[model samples]
Target: MRIRATVATVTAAALSAALAVTALAAPAAGAEQDDTPTQIKNIEVNQNRDYTVVVEAARKVKFPISALVHDPSGIKSVSFSLQHGATEAEVDGRIAQVGPSRCVKVDESWSKCEAVMIADPYTNVRSNALAGAWGINIVAVDGEGNVTREDYMPLARIKRKTHLSLADATPEPVKKGKNLTVKARMIVASWEKHKDVPLIGHQVLLQFRQGASGPFKTLKKVRTDRNGWATATVQATVDGQYRYDFAGTSLTQARSGLADFVDVK
Candidate 1:
């Protein structure tokens, strides 16, 4: 009886160890799969169903137009065309637009030649858009009804290269009907890199916007110099609160999308 009990105890111990090992291994495998980008070639969409555009970073996240898009009357399916701050945004999912900012493609879908859905809405002057804190826009229902149109931004992956500062970190707020000359100093504890691989001297993309709903606007914004320093001045026309963000192509140690707000009223 003594020997039998001892054997049972050893068996139980081995089983426990195996179970623990498996538990740890399972999560790691799942995480890798989640982070891995999906492979798809094109983006195509029809009217009726609205498109949700999300831009978090600079890399082009691949998505299969058929994975979640069902071919139906309301366009249960869609695609994306992404252009990091260049005029034409991504089309269905892979066409690169680099001309104007009014139409991603006038083939049928309404788009800016080179436009950000929510950011500047102005891409003609955008340079190094993918390198800083910029907003991305998707062309959803133009009129908000069942219409025959090529869907823009069928899917979105919220990715960003820079780390945003904390909200309320910028200068003080100003009242409405005013403009701003935003500026700040960020200590470059260390340098960061971007997936877009900006030039040698360019380190950060400086941007500003009025209120929370305004496009990630940039008015005379400056790029980060060799010392990892940057500054920008934004002019607001009708603002309640104005804010700006310091963003890099690489992750900011402080955080991504860090912002400081000021009231205009």
Candidate 2:
């Protein structure tokens, strides 16, 4: 059984700001019914040099989405959308539609279609309630009125932009063998607050490197506290730089903080 999705149109201004909206010609009126089902294949989505869709603050963002549509009766139109909640009723109003345009007929039975997926923090994702995996929805139609849809397919994860900071690394010019404490904080962009806040109970790595050229070696691993602070102490041995690293999780992006140089006298 094929489930139909209710796709809402994004604002004209938002579409104009995102990309040039072109209207793909639909099949002519009174087209004959061929009983052929449209099939969507080879779908791809990309943004921020990654498969994951990264949403930012301020204005709307656009990314390219491409797919191949096949139907023996001839292709009509193809479009894409986003779904974030468990049920269609929950996410129906939040649907971010990718304007159907830029489709080229490969042959009589196949067409290559490309569209831009728009992410507007202000409109589409107004709050954290719409966070997490925003599934990709593809809808294809054939000239014979036969329809095919891939609903809420988890192609790539949708994540808000995140950042990590090495707030402080103490004992700047400590004597050899003395203990030096390193402090850091991890924060993620909040859609509701519109600011970055500390992310708690996450693992962080304490790393050190000699001078400014070589790779940083992990000294110890520590987890962040309720206050979103990760602290670890290490004995001063040689002159080098210390830093904090977060491998991140499925919900966040991996980040490395700035290294703090400490002179061991």
Candidate 3:
């Protein structure tokens, strides 16, 4: 009976130690299974010109990240970084910090977040780092500490102010019903170099005002030649002011200045 009692005591002690180890290991296994990978989908970037990503002048740029977080604890935050290259560390000073802004919950497991990036004209024009291909980084985190990150390269370009000039209408004093010539020139920013160059193949509108205080009416449209010069001919009817309007493009803004006056006898 004494030997049997000692054997029973040893078996009980071994069972207790095994139970303690199993209890500790169970939580770790559960943790591994609970970690569900987050999914990112339907990402977009824009600079306020429809879906175009080109940036000209100072404007509010937007980056939207759509994601489906699989963790049961829900999403915690979403962060964005705008940089010149693929990675943040590749371009240090050029990177713009976009906020871990509030994500709008679309459904139980899906959300969308937007980050507004400010493009400063002066800062971008001066920095060579901002002129080329730029990228955005999106990071999403869940309450359970699971993280998902994605990278995208959005085509972008920095623009400069264009110079437009309308020369005085040739033949200042002209007879009624005679054709009068309107001439103008446009100078646009060059992306390849720092200097501005003559803008070619752009449409320029010729507008005429009946009198000094009257509204201007569109007379005709003329395309600029290789020399950045546009010419249009209109029949002189009365004393009026003439000007050229250059409609903007994806890379530049529309421009018009003071009009040139002409007298008809």
Candidate 4:
């Protein structure tokens, strides 16, 4: 009976030591689980130009986020409803959510997500959706429920299409002292119509070059009319080329290609 009692006491002590070790380990495991720092890397957007978001991580992010992501399903949640400049109210309906199928494992520690954003004029546009600066809010959740979030990503929405052309020039070959009439047209995308339309009341520069390999000199600044056309008159003094340059706006910039040469007698 004395030997049996000693054996039972030893077993109880061992069990208590095992329970103490497990209690000490529980907090450590929880700390490791919460220490994950999931982050966005190599974030890029195809905005005015295809560029990496290196400057502010918030500036010039292209609208419609899905267009930039590789896998749309990887992104857990995203929102462009926050208007930094515009007066549009936050609409939760605009929030985009992606499923697990769109996410792909980059490694054991991280995953890549992708999603798309839709532009709604009534709900998305506050003042002018196009040709304005905006903000985006994002929340990324991994399979382990580890979350990464970023607010106030800068975005610029510019969807303008500009065109400049030297429509007609009087008398292909003319005497040196003769007057030359030049007509040009400028076209830009209409924000309301979603199509190319005339850009009225915009300055168009008429430039002239003395020779084939000479630098262009601005001869005149003409403004487009209701028809998006500008006309200028100049004296034919030398055999050279003529082109039109449309000074871009906050929305778009355009320049005419090399115009056909005009030979002066």
Candidate 5:
């Protein structure tokens, strides 16, 4: 009877150990999939749909970026990167990254994250040649270690700040129906010198309005010369204002010069 009791106790202990192992291996109730990736949504940079970054000088310019993220396992981090090119080979040496920012919890499954990008042309202009359109890259991680990476999304355009100045309109008092010359110059901000430099070989529009307060009409388009000068000769029809307008290009910003009033005799 004693030997039979010892064998029964060993069998019962073995059965209990197997049952405990099975319970430990099973998933808990209401558990989520550990492989689900975090989702990114509603990304906005500086609250502008088409945010244009104009580098005025050799200084640093800062802007805010925000996004909404969702994950079943909860959000761990959200990061941002500013890139110039599309492929990895193109952006390998020209990328700017902002580390994970504080995220505000919206719910059990969603969070809002915010970050800032500082564009310094004097220091980091090598990133994408320091001009034209740039993209924003995003990477999100969930509580379960699942990650989601999005690359090369349209975020902002980096352009050089420019100005148009109407130098002169001569003759000041000219007879109606006579040829009048309008002179202008186009200059852009230089990142290295922090000064205005000539922007040559660019188109500038000569615009005229009948009065001091009215819609102006484009008279003609003239290209800037080697001296950054754009000149147009038009018939002086009446007493009005003349100005130069730059519609902007891929690397420069649009600018309208102050009007120069002329009296018709």
Candidate 6:
């Protein structure tokens, strides 16, 4: 039951550009599979102070990770510490033990690891609470070098604070006989101010479903092309729980950040 994920070759330069203006990095030399996963940044919280650090997995390998330090049945223990710029990083997460087959036990690929520590050597499992926003360089080491070599989470991309005026989305409750309508907008800053954020030009698809608990339905999908706006309409159903999902990009549809929950009538 080891989960294997396809590694896509995304240029680090592309991600660097998404960050604040900086000199572009030459793509690491290698075929897609040979290259390591990009170092994702946790810099949005504090540009110069406390921040979260995320170490990415190899494109070819899938491993379950604990945000903190606890042994999940199927993943191995992975840990690291960082010190960069003005900040010092102390992480405390346990890696899920991977069986010999090395499949991905965890369903999702990206997560804010839960293991926390006021210091790095011990257990401090609060996956989301971060102490300081200081930026720094990180080095991650794992036992299975065959599957995952060491990786880094960059310090430059941290956002000291979130934009209060950024736009968000919500979906109408789906009915047994009716459809659903998905909506999007920029509530924080003007359409122009959000240019740096990737959600703006994204061609989005709205997805929803409800049932006893099984394969969910793909209710609807659409594109966001008009002035920093997108919308979708779908027939709603009489399911007890309703969830609105985004189409393509991973970061767009968050129940907290980009998605919505609605109760059916």
Q: Which candidate achieves the best TM-score against the true structure?
A: 5
TM-score of each: 0.27, 0.76, 0.52, 0.61, 0.79, 0.29
Q: Rate residue 117 of model 3 by lDDT.
A: 57
Sort all candidates by TM-score, best to worst. 5, 2, 4, 3, 6, 1
Candidates' lDDT values, in order? 0.32, 0.69, 0.60, 0.51, 0.72, 0.31
Best by lDDT: 5
1-265 per-residue lDDT for model 5 (tens digits): 0011111112233344434433444345666546655677888776664677777765667777778999887777777767665544464323354555879999999999888777776666533256776677665666654445665434567778898885589987999999999998888877777777888899988999997888999999999998789999999988899999999977788999988999999
Off by over 4 Å in 6: 1-176, 186-198, 211-217, 240-243, 246-265
TM-score of 6: 0.29
Candidate 3 or 5, higher TM-score? 5
Q: Candidate 4, which segments miss by more than 4 Å at Cα?
A: 1-32, 35-37, 47-129, 213-215
Ranking by lDDT: 5, 2, 3, 4, 1, 6
TM-score of 2: 0.76
Return the lDDT, model 3, position 122: 49
Tell me the TM-score of model 1.
0.27
lDDT for each residue of candidate 2 in 1-265, tens digit (9 for 90 to 100): 1122333423334344223222233335675546555677777777334557666644566878778888886666677766665555455424545655577989888898888877777777767555566666766666654455566444556676667785476778899999999898777766667777777888989999998769999999999898778899999999888899888666677789998898899
Query: What tens-digit string does per-residue lDDT give for candidate 4 at 103-125?
Result: 45665545544444434333332
Which pairs clash in model 2? none
- By summed lDDT, the worst window of 10 consecutive residues in model 5 runs over 1-10
List, residue by residue over 123-188, the lDDT tens digit for candidate 6.
221222222232222222112211221223333221111121222323444455675566664211
Candidate 3, 1-265: lDDT as tens digits:
0011111112233344434433443433336433556666655556333333433333433434233334355666666655564443454334454455667777887777666555554453344345555555555566544444555554343334567895558787999999899898887755345556788899988998888887878899889899888888989999989998987774565688469988899
After superposition, the stretches of candidate 2 with alpha carbons farther than 4 Å from their true spots are 1-33, 47-50, 57-59, 87-93, 106-108, 143-145
Quote the positional error of residue 147 for candidate 5 in Å.
Answer: 1.9
* lDDT accuracy of residue 204 in candidate 5: 89
Alpha-carbon RMSD to native, per candidate:
21.6, 6.3, 15.6, 15.8, 14.5, 17.5
For residues 55-98, what per-residue lDDT tens digits would candidate 1 score against the true structure? 22223322222212111212211222333322233211123233
Better of 2 and 6 by lDDT: 2
For residue 25, model 2's alpha carbon misses the true position, in angstroms, by 10
